[model samples]
Target: MNQLEQLKKYTKVVIDSGDIENITHYTPYDATTNPSLVLKAIQMKKYEYLLQKSINYAKKKGGLKNQIVTNATDKIIVSIGAEILKKIPGVVSSEVDSRLSFNTEKSIKKAKKLISLYEVEFGIDRSRILIKLASTWECIQAAKKLEQEGIHCNLTLLFSFAQARACAESKVFLISPFVGRISDWYSINYSSNKYRSSLDPGVQSVKKIYEYYKKHDYKTIIMGASFRNIKQVLSLSGCDCLTISPELLSILQAKNKLITKKLFIPKKIYAKPIKKLSHSEFLWLHNQDPMAVEKLSQGIRQFGTDQYLLEEIVTKNM
Candidate 1:
C-alpha cells in the first residue's frame, strides 16, 4: 500500500481544501475549509458556479450591500461545504467568522446561523457538519454551549496547551493543533535545523496534546492540522485525525513506503485528575506561551483578511 493507504489504518484522513473537485480525488474521510481556502477556491473557474449560486441566494434576501455581501460569503462557504459533503462520507467543518473570535455571544449566533444554512438551505444534516471556530477562550466557551445544544465544533488555530486543555474541558468534538505553523514559528525565531529531526516542534505539540487526552481518557478528538510538509502529516500517524492539504495527500498516495504509528495510548496514566481551567488561568497561560500568543493573533488577522477579500469579490458581482 502507498503511504496514504497505510496512514489511513492509523489516522482518520481529512482533506483540508475548499475545492470540491480536488476533495473528490483524495477520498478523505472528512473535509475542512477556512476563509483563506474558501477565498482561493472561489477565484478558480471551476468553482465560479458556486459564487453565482451564492450571489443569487443572497440577492433573494434583499438586504443592504454590506448585509448582502456578508450573506453571500456565508452562502459560498456553506455551498462549497455542502458539495464536498456529497463526496466524503464523514463531516465537513464549516468555519464561522474569525472576526467574532473575541465575542462569545456573537460567535454562538454565527455558528448557529452556519448550521442553519447547512441544514435548512443545503438540506444537509447537522450531524454531518462540524462548526469551525477559533481556539480563543471566548470561542471555546461558545463551543461548550453549542456542544450542549448538540452542535459539535472543530476548534482551529490552536497552538498552546491551554487551548487544548480548555477544549478538552469543554468537550468540544475536535481540536485541530496546527503542526506546520508551530514548526514555522520555531524555524524562524530559532533555527530550521533545530526541528529537522522527526521530533519537529509542530509534531511534538500534537504528540503532547494527544498523550494528555489519552492519559486522561478525554472524549474530545485531537485532529492534527496545518501541515507544511508530508513529514508533519506522517509524524502524527496515530492521531485521531489529520487535516491535510491535497498537495501532500497526492504525495502520500504516490509513495509506497510503509509508515509506522508514531503515537499511541499510554499504558499507564502519568498525571492525576486535572482541574479545568478558569477564564483567567486560561488567558494567563496562553499569554505566557509567546508562540501561541503571536500565532493565534496572526492567524485570526490572516483569516479575517481573506474573508474580507472574499466579500470584495462578492460585492463586485453584486
Candidate 2:
C-alpha cells in the first residue's frame, strides 16, 4: 500500500480546504473549512459565482446593507461547506465567528445559527456537520452546552495540553491540535539540535494529548492540523485524524507508496494523568508558555481579520 493508504489504516485523513474541486482528487475522509479558506476560495475566478450568488440572495432579503452583507457572508460559507460535503465521505467542519470566542452564550448562539443555516437553509444534515469553535475556556463551555443539545463540535486552534484537557473534559466531539504552528514556534525559540523532527515540540504536544486521551479512554477525537511539511504529517501517522492543506495532501498523494506508520495503540506505551489546572493555574500556564499564548491569540486575530475581509467582499458585491 502507498503511504496515504497506510496512514488511513491508522488515521482518518481530512482535507482542509474550501475548494471542493481540489478535494475530490485526494478523496479525504472528511473536510474542514474556515472563514479564511472560504474567502480565499471565493476570490478565485471559478468561485466568483459563489460570492455573486450570496450577494444576490442578500439583495433579495431587502434589509440594511450591513445586515445584507452579514447574511450574505454566512450564506456563502455555508454554501461552500455544503458543496464540499458532496465530495468527501465524512464530516465537514464549519467555523463560527472568531470575535465570539470569549462569550460563551454568544458562541453557542452563533453555533446554533450556523447549524440551522446548514441544515434548514442549505439542506445538509446535522450529523455530517461539526461546528468549529476556538479552544478558549469560554468556547469550551459553549461546546459543552452545544454537545448536550446534540450539536457536535470541533474544538480548533488548540495549542497546549491545557486546552486539550479542557476539551476532553467537556466531551467535545473532536480537538484539532495544530502541528506546524507549534513547530514554527519551537524553531524560533530553541536551537536546531533541540528540535528533531521526531522530537519536534509540535509533534510532542499532539503525542501528549493522544496519550492522555487513550489513558483515560476519552472519546474526544484528536485531529492534528496546520502541517508545514511532510515530516510533521508523518510524525502524526496514527492520530484519529489529520486535517491537511491541499499542498501537503498533494505531496502525500504523490508519495503514497512511501508513507509508513509511526503511531498506533497508545496503551503499549507508558501513560500518565494530565496535571489538572485550576483557573489560576490555567492562567499561569498560559502566561508561562509564551508560544501557546502567542499562537492562540494570533490564530484568533488572523481568522477574525479574514472574516472581516469576507464581510467586505460580500458588501462590495452587494
Candidate 3:
C-alpha cells in the first residue's frame, strides 16, 4: 500500500479543501473547509455554478445588499459542503462567519443557520455536519451551547495547550491544531533546520495535546491540520484525525512507504484529576504563549478578510 493507505490504518484522514472535486480521489473519511478555502474554490470556473446558484437564492430572500451578500456567502459555503457530503461518507465541517467569532450569541446564531441550510435546504442530516468555529472564549462558549442543541463542533485555529485544554473541557467534538502554521512561526523566529518530524514544534504541539487528552481521558477528538509536508503527516500517523491538503495527499498516495505509528495511548495511567481552565485562566495561559496569541489573531483576521473577498464575489454576481 502507498503511504496514504498505510497511514489510514491508524489515523482518520480528512480532506482539507472547499473544492469538493478533489475529495473523491482522496476518499478521506471527513472533509473540512474555512473562509479562505471557500473563497479559493468559488473563484474556480468549475465551481462558478454554485456561486451563481447561491446568488439567486440570496436575491430571492430580498434583503439589503450587505445582508444579501452574507446570505449568499453562507449559501455558497453550504452548497459546497452539501456537494462534499455526497462524496464522503463522514461529516463535512462548514465554518461560521469569522466576523462573528468574538460574539458568542451571533456565532451560535450563525452556526445554527448554517446547520439549518444543510438540513432543511440540502436535505442533509445534522449528524453529518460539524459546525466549525474559532477557538475564542466566546466561540468556545458558543460551541458549548450548540453542542447542547445536538450541533457538534470542530474548533479551528487552535495553537496553545490552553486552547486545547479548554476545548477538551467543553467536550467539543473535535479540535484542529495546525501543524504547519506552528512550524512556520518558529521557522521565521528561530532556526528552521533544528526541527524535523518528532522535534518539529508543530508536530510536538499535537503530540503534547494528544497525550494530555489520553492521559486525562478527555473525549474531545484531536485532528491535526495545516500540514506543510508529508513528513509532518507521517509524524502524526496515529492521531485521532488529520485534515490534509490535496497537494500533500497526492504525494502520499504516489509514494509507497511504510508508516509506523508515532502517537500511542499509554496502557497504564495514575494521576490526580486536574481542574478545568476558567475563562480568565484560559486567557492568561494563552496570552503567555506568544505564538498562540499572534497566530490566533492572525488566523481570525485572515479568515475575515477572505470572507469579505467571498462577499465581494457574491456582490458581483448579484
Candidate 2, residue 178: the lDDT equals: 91
Model 1 lDDT tens row, 21-92: 898788899999999999999999998899999999999998898888999999999998999999999999
Candidate-wise lDDT, in order: 0.93, 0.87, 0.93
Better of 2 and 3 by lDDT: 3
* Candidate 3 Cα errors over 4 Å, as ranges: 192-194, 270-272
20-136, model 3: which lDDT tens digit per residue? 889999999999999999999999999999999999998999878888888899999999999999999999999998888999999999999999999889899899999999999
Give me the displacement of residue 224 in model 2, in angstroms: 0.3
Give the total clashing residue pairs for model 2.
3
Give the C-alpha lDDT of model 3: 0.93
- lDDT, model 1: 0.93
Error of 1 at 136 (Å): 0.4
Cα-based TM-score, every candidate: 0.98, 0.94, 0.98
Root-mean-square deviation (CA) per prediction: 1.2, 2.2, 1.1
- Tens-digit per-residue lDDT, 35-106, candidate 2: 789889989999888889888877888788888888888788888998898898889999999999999999
